[model samples]
Target: MTITTHSVTLDGVEQRYHVAGNGPVCLAHSGGPGIAWDYLRMRPLEEHLTMVYVEPIGTGESGRLAADTDYTLDNYVRYLHVVVEDLAAGPVALLGHSHGGFVVQKYALAHPVDALVLYDTSARTGAEFFGDAVANIQRHGQKILAAFTSQHAEMTNDELTDVLRTIMPAYFADWRVEFEPLRAAMRIWSGPSRGQDVPFDVREQLSALDVPALVVVGEDDFICGPRWAQELHRALPSSRLRVIEHCGHIAHVERPDVFYPEVLKFLS
Candidate 1:
C-alpha cells in the first residue's frame, strides 16, 4: 500500500485524509459520530483496490471547527463532496460501514456514484436512527469518553468481540466462531457516539436512482435488519439487497470472507 496524506480546504477548514492501494477506487468511510480513523485498516482489500479512507472533520487527523460546528448529515454530505473532489475521482464504488452508510447514501443520491456497497447499512429515516443514538449519549456521554485517549485499541479485545457478537449472528448463517482482526479494527473504527440528529425522507428518492447499488444487511441486525434492507432495495430500482443469513450490524466485520467477496462481486 503506497500510503499518502493530503489536506483539502473545505469552507476554509483544512481536512486531512489518507489514501492507499491501487485498483478500482473506493472511498472507505468509518462509522461513529466522533470515532478515530485507525479502525479502517482493510489492508487485504487494499491489495485489490485503492482505498481512500477519510477522517471526517473534527475526528482523527481531520481538522476541527468551532465547538458549535454542526456535524449534521447535510454538512457531512458536503464534507464527503470535498474529499471526493480532492481525490479528483468524480465517481467511485462508494463503500460505507454502519453509520457511514448514511453518509455515502446521501452522496450517491446527490451525485452519480459508480456503485455502492453498503454493509449492515440503512437508507430510511425515522426515529430508529436518532432515538438510540441520543439515548446513548444521555446514558454514557462523558463517564467513559473522558477517559478515552488517542489509542488504537480503545477497548479490550474480548469486550470488542462481545459487543459485536450482539449483531454478528444475524449477518451470516452461523456464529460461535472467530472473526478476523480487521473486523475488530472496524468495531474500533465505529465508536459508540452518535452524530447530530438530522432526519430526511430519503426513501422516496431511492426508486428514482439510475445507478447500481447493493444493500447488505445481517438477518440479526434488529436495528437495520432484513426488513430495513428490503425497504432500501424497493426504493432504488437498480438496487439489490442480500441478506446475510447469520450476521448482524457489523456484517462486513463479522463475516469478512462473506462480506469482502460479496462486495467484490457487486463491484465487479
Candidate 2:
C-alpha cells in the first residue's frame, strides 16, 4: 500500500523510478517509448512482490535529451541497463508491456534475469505485425475506419488520448461498456518525441534467451493480437504463452483476475 519514488542519474539524464511493497524485485517497464509508467502499476502484484516502475526518458520526472537525441532501441537498452545495474542487486523479474515488452526482450538478451513477463508485445516492430493489425480493424467495418482516421502524427498528450478514445473499441472486447473505467485509469504522456524509422527485428536473437519467460496476450487484441504473442512464444526457447479469452490489448488492466495470478504463479 505504501510506495516510494526515487531517481538516479545516468549520463546527464535524471532517470526516475518507483518502488513499492516487499519481497523479490520486479523491474517493470512501460510501453509507448514515450508514455509514463503509472498505467502498469498493477496493485495486485504489489501485495506479493516488490514492484519497481521505470519511467521512460522524457516522461514523468525523467530527464529529457536534446531534440536531436537518439531515441533508438539501443540507446534505450543502455539507459535501462544502467538503471537496473544501479538498482537491482541480483537477478530480478523483468516485466514489460507493449513497446516495453520489446525493450525487455532485448534486455534479457543482454542481461540475465530470474524471469521475464511480456504482455501484449511482438518479436518485431515491422510490417509483419502492423500490416495484420490494419486488415483486422478493417474487417470490423467503417466505424473502425473513422477511428483510424482520427490518428495523426506528432500529437500532444490530450490529442493522443482523444485519438485513442476514438479507437478504444479496438483495444477491448467489451469496449462499449468498459471503455470509461479503462480510460479513467489510463494516463497518457507525450514528452520530446520523434519517429522510429530504424529497423528492429529480434526474432533470430530469441532462441538464445534461456531464462524462463511468460508471453501473455489478449485473445481479442486488435493490434498485437494473440498471433504475435504466439510467434514470440515459439521463438523463445524457454517461453510459455497464455491467452486471456475475451480480453484485448491491455490484458493486465482488463483481466487482472487472471493476469495477476498467472504472473504470481510464474514468479513463484
The C-alpha TM-scores of every prediction are 0.76, 0.91
lDDT by residue (158-268, candidate 1, tens digit) is 454444434333333444446544344443323323334556558887767778888888776645667667877887888778888767666655667777787778777
- Give the residue spans of candidate 2 off by over 4 A: 139-152, 176-179, 191-193
Runs of candidate 1 exceeding 4 Å displacement: 128-196
- Candidate 2, lDDT over the whole model: 0.80
lDDT score of residue 248 within candidate 1 = 60
Q: CA lDDT of each candidate? A: 0.67, 0.80
Every candidate's CA RMSD: 6.6, 2.1
Query: The CA-based lDDT of model 1 is what?
Result: 0.67
Prediction 1 TM-score vs. true: 0.76
